[model samples]
Target: MTTIKLHNTKTRKREDFNPIDDKNVRMYVCGPTVYDRAHLGNARPVIVFDVLNRLLRHVYGEDHVTYVRNFTDVDDKINARAAESGRSIGDITAETTQWFLDDMAAVGALEPDHMPRATAYILQMVEMIEGLIAKGHAYAADEHVLFAVESYKEYGALSGRSIDDMIAGARVEVAPYKRNPMDFVLWKPSDDATPGWDSPWGRGRPGWHIECSAMADELLWKEPLRQDRLSEGAKSQPHVFDIHGGGLDLQFPHHEDEIAQSCCANGTDEMARYWLHNEMLQVEGKKMSKSLGNFFTVRDLLDQGVPGEVIRFVMLSTHYRKPMDWTEKKRDEAEKTLRKWLDLTRDLQPSDPTTFAPDQKLLDAVADDLNTHLALTYLNALTAQPQKLLDHARWLGFLGDKARQDDEKARSAYTTSMGSGASDALASLANRLDELRQTAMQSKDFSQVDAFKTALLAAGVEVRMSKTGVDLQPASNFDLAKLDALK
Candidate 1:
């Protein structure tokens, strides 16, 4: 078994991953709010965790891993969008949820084993809140139930902040209630117009932090659906799952509150064994925001004909722990590289099924706290083994069925524009041009090289000459007839 290591945000160190039940490895990542389209920054954690999920499936058997990402359908943002757009909350959430799934699928993310909606799990949230109140960890005041932060001794352990610092530095809701300033809401009353369900605290909805805690407990740990897989001890208290993950922006308040609620309610030392968080993203070296004029959604890029694989590749080139900068230069470079790799492996067949496995070097790179940039560097050196390269790239969520079909169509069109032997002829011409350039470099004379380059340009071929070699490809306005003179 490969010893997978991950950086735990709770401990702030990289450690070996030891699952509570290796036969049933579990993970939960915080998902989208589903109020609108997911912007470019939103795609970072999706891609980062997608890669980690793939690795988990590879290390453990595919069926052994259980991944759950929740959908926050019952958020204030959804309510506001509904009122502003003159649409029902249900209609808005449904449409926005589908949009999120489509955009995420475009980037080659596999759907998690469970996608629990917060609305569907309201009963569980209510039950958890009741338990918290019973245990004196929470109290009902002013038609709302708030978690008493003072009751939990290790309230700020996850975020490493003192309650005084949190109160001073973070936003604290100063309601005239009998509680500490850092106390958070577990359930708030909702009016008849708002989306609400029947709760002990009147008609209301669950707060954002408690939603994840309840849903994660139900789906990942204590669900009756997976009771058969549980041990006698696990069945008693299954609150501490293997991994919990989200973005760095969510490290404070959101995740901290979840930790406090889950631990205090379930009577556990920790909510999860390992916590992972991917850093935020930027656009062109600046923060991505609408005010910065660099903000765009994933769907926007897809509509502009940017291949999903290109987006995935550019994202993976940066380490997940570091801030990723999206730039046009990086996008173009990634596209060019994927094009070359796809063309190289076009004629190759899939590796034998019995012997099928990802390259050891690449797997090792990713296993080291998801060093995707290094894994990609290892992939670039696997061209000599085309089948291995193709298989490994696919394993990393590249070169899917669509990409292969698109590459085939592109190659076929280029072949038809020239002749049946056009590919071979172009290769021969590229070699010939390279020889001329090498001779010119040695003799300090470039008459032949310059003339060949000019002729190739006139024929609508993009001639790229470098120290590496010469590469020739048809441009949009390629004229096969003009190339006849050079042939």
Candidate 2:
């Protein structure tokens, strides 16, 4: 068995992963809050944990690993969006939830074993809140239930911050009813205009932090054992899952609060054995912001003809702990590489997944803290073994059935549309673009290159120019007359 090592945020060290039960391994990753489209930054943790999920399934038997990612359907953000858009809360949440699912699926991510909606688990959340109050870890005041942060001595252990530091660093909500400044809300009163559930305190909704804790506890800790899906050893240690993961930004208050709530409510020292957090993302070496003109969503990239495989490839190009910068140069390079790989293994049959075994070095690289960059390097070197290359690429969520079929369809379409004469014309146009680009690079003026590229794009041709040269392909709306005019 390949030993897996992960960087645990709780301990801040890379440790060997030993699941409580080898027969059944469980992982929970915080998922998106469906208020709007999932932006590029949101996709980071999705792909990062998606890779880890794939690795775990590969090492353990496919059926043995259980992955749960939650959907936060009820949140203030969703409410605000609903009010601003003049749409019902349910309508907005349903639409945005499907958008998130479609965008993630396009990025080659497998749906987890469970994707629980926060609204669906409101009863569990209320029950957990009641347990906390009974245990003297929470108090209700002003029709709002707040977790007593001082009650949990190790409240800031996961983030490695003291109570004083948390007060200073976090945007602590100072309420007249809160016992301490750092105390967070478990439940808050909601008016008739807002979405609310009937709870012990009043008609209100669960706070963001409590939603995750309750859902994770219900799905990972209790429900699995209740269903007899886990071995006896796994059930012995309740309230502790194998791994919990999210982005670094969530480390401060959200995750810290989850730890305090789950541990205090369930009488456990830890909510999860290993806490994993991926670093943030950037665009063109700068933070992605609408003000910066670089902010976009996963759907944005997909709409611009950048394939989801390319996005996943570029994301995994860097180690998860490092900040990943999305640049056009990197995007072009990734597209080129994936196209080449797809061409090489176009008609090759992959090994049966049940009996499939990846190259040892490739598996080891991934197992070593999910060094996807090194694993990609190893994948790039497997071109000689076409079968290995195809199987391994599929394992890494690339060149799968859809990708191969799409590549074949595109190639066939291009061939049928372009006779020998038009093929020569397309090649000639590519050579012309290459010459103009080289000249512009030397002269430091790109007016001619830009104009020609714009014209090609207007004619529905895909223009990809890189350091090597220019490669042009005709789209479904290709215009031979446009090419002749350029010639």
Candidate 3:
């Protein structure tokens, strides 16, 4: 059995992962705040962490791994969306969240073991707030209760930001009721028009960060265990779980506050043994935003006929902790790579009795903190040898009988529509692109190479350049005459 090591955000170092029971490994990933359609930026964490979850299930038994990803159903953003759409908050959240789930499923992200909603856990949130008040970690203001930042001495440990710095950086409005600038709201009184629940403090709603802490404790740690009659004298358990993961953007006040709240309420030093944060995704090396006109929703990409698998592959190509720049060229390259793998395994016998012999070095790379980039290097090595590539693609969840069938149908339709001479023209263009790309590489003129590749793609040829060399294919249903006219 391979030992899995992960970079623990809490300790700021890489550490060997050892589950509490060695039989039941529990992980929690912060999920989407579903107020709008999920963007391509949002897809990174879903696919990257999903792969990690798959790797865990592979290492441990499937039933032994429990993964929880929560949905933030009750948030200010949801309320604002509800108002904008002229729908109830519940309706908006439910509809958008369903869309999010569908998009994630399309990208091959497995449904979590539990998808706890903030609205469903109101009672738990209330209980936690009451506990915090009783413990003197929180206090009530006029119709609201705020967590006392001063009470938690280790408040800055997780984010490495001093309380003063946090106060300065905080975008939160300073309500007159808050005791300190750095203090955050646990419960804020709700108006008649807004969503609310009757709590000890007042009729209010849970704060955004509080929902995750409460839900995680309730669903993961505090749930009762009812054993079957076969196991006499079986005891309920409260053993520590393993990991918590989210985007790097959450490393600040969000995760820091969660750690403070959960540890203080539970009276434990560690809320999560390991904390993992995947880096953000950028569009053309700029932050993705609608105002910037670079933002792209996952649905938008889907509507453009980009396969969900190709999207997933592009997300996983970069290291999880490294920022990835999304570009059409990258997507085209990933599509070509997938097409090659698909073509290699298209005619292979289903029961060919191929051994599941993945390169041990590749496995080691993945296990050493889920280095997907290195794993892809190994994948490219396999692709260099077509026979070996078909066998190895199984490890990537790509080149099985099912994958072959699916790709063959898609590929045949794609190729037949391109006419007789189109394939040969595409092949010639690919060869030219490779030669030009190589010259660019030798001259270290990557910009020109990128432009040349884009030109080929514009002319209805897809090209992938990697360490192993260049691989190319005709675009799906490409119209060579139309392409030539456009060029």
| Highest-scoring model, TM-score | 1
Cα lDDT tens digits, model 3, 38-102, are 99888888887787887787787676777889999888888887888799887788888999998
The weakest ten consecutive residues by lDDT in model 2 span 224-233
lDDT of 2 at 196: 94
lDDT of 1 by residue, 1-487 (tens): 7889999989999999988877788899999999999998888888999999999988888878999998999989999998899999999889989999999888889999999899999999999999999999999999999999999999888889999999989878899875898999999999887999999889999889999999988888777767778667566656888999999999899999999999988999999999999998999999999998999999999998788889999999999999999999998778777876786788887665335688678888999999999999988998778877888888898888788887678767878766766667678889999999989989999999999998987786777766789899875346777877887
- Best by the lDDT measure: 2
Candidates arranged by lDDT, highest first: 2, 1, 3
Q: How far is candidate 3 from the true structure (C-alpha RMSD, Å)?
A: 5.8
Question: Tens digit of lDDT per residue, candidate 2, span 110-141?
Answer: 99999999999999999999999999999999
Kindly indicate the candidate among 2 and 3 with the higher TM-score.
Answer: 2
**Residue 3 deviation, candidate 3, in Å?**
1.8
- TM-scores for all candidates: the values are 0.90, 0.88, 0.84
CA lDDT, candidate 1, residue 216: 88
- The per-residue C-alpha lDDT of model 3 at residue 423 equals 68
Name the weakest run of 10 consecutive residues (lDDT summed) in model 3.
226-235
Which pairs clash in the backbone of model 2?
Answer: none
